[model samples]
Target: MLTSYTIAVIGGTGPQGKGLGYRFARHGHTVVLGSRSAEKAVPVAEEVAARLTGVDGAGAVSGAANAEAVAQADVVLLAVPWDGHDELVGSLDLAGKTVISCVNPLAFDKRGAHGAVVDAGEGSAAEHAQQLAPEATVVGAFHNVSAVHLWGEYDYLDEDVLVVGDVVEAKQVAQDLAVAVTSRRGIDAGKLRLARVLEPLTAVLISVNRKYKVNSGLRISGLEGIER
Candidate 1:
């Protein structure tokens, strides 16, 4: 299974994955929605295509396995779970491409994010992915974002993106992806090392969700608006 990577969403079968795939496709990126099964991926890609502004509502996209998608994409989005995270990174061919890691590393039974993968140096899932995918420029982003809200519009969720990556080009690609989806902007938060802090925020947000009983997000208020 291989989806071309002009821009591809790996694990696009999930809710968050589909939302981003849809948003990026809407922004005119020739998107591939990656899944374990190509047949399963087709419908999701078609659904995203149906929403694009200028694209024929009948637009079609490619789908394939994780590696094939990454191989072809200029940029790749990783929305896989924590368990699959390192495994995928270890197997990917990231010679010159920008990699986006969108994992939160939270363990849950029913309530949600009850625990985290404590083995990581900083216990950050995104940082772990950055370490595993050293060859690729790993950027940390979209961990706590609500895909349901991102897919449509939910007043509770604000869309500012925090881009963290060691490589400037990769970070910019991440920023572009973020800006394309949300009405808000992307802020480069230095290097990928910072994901140690950002990843845990997923757990923190979970605690907030438990306390407030709602999906919540962050918004840094004073920066002037910037274009993608």
Candidate 2:
């Protein structure tokens, strides 16, 4: 397993990105919160670092513009909204990096949330990312995990992260990192194609949360002592 990593959260000013950044930092991995501008991300990074004060095993936290953050990171997590997903991702030079996409393309309406139709026709954001940056190894994960619980006062979340990728080595890297949030290895949900299911599943979780007024997450069964 990799001992340490410099993780860059692309949409770090947002709740999901900030929450993930907090978790990674808490686990002793360097985290850089990235936004369109460094000015927007710096204060948020400061706020996250402030919250980790006196916390054991916390790593260094910083902020930068998206491109700068990606340039410095070993692993990059895309948590930006779907609207600008293409533009932002296409703009970055992500060659030879492990890119974890947690962005869910979904449209919210009066009825509820549902998967948005992707223009790339790749079925999910992860696949779209793969298309845009073919040189980078793209993995799909953290789609269904709760942003609230991640940044909340909880020590660790009780959930299973489903990681999908065409590359086995890259997938394992993401699985190992899952312990930072879920306190367990991420389940190898299958190839990058499966992201179609995992991405849209977030909408179902959101709907469930609204109905039950709880932060719902996934828990896989029958995998006891089974390593993926």
Model 1 vs truth, CA RMSD: 4.4
Per-model lDDT: 0.71, 0.93
Candidate 1 per-residue lDDT over residues 75-103, each given as its tens digit:
87888877767777677777667778887
User: Cα miss at 210, model 2 (Å)?
Assistant: 0.7
Error of 2 at 158 (Å): 0.6
Question: How far is 138's C-alpha from truth in model 2 (Å)?
Answer: 0.3
Q: Please give each candidate's TM-score.
A: 0.83, 0.97
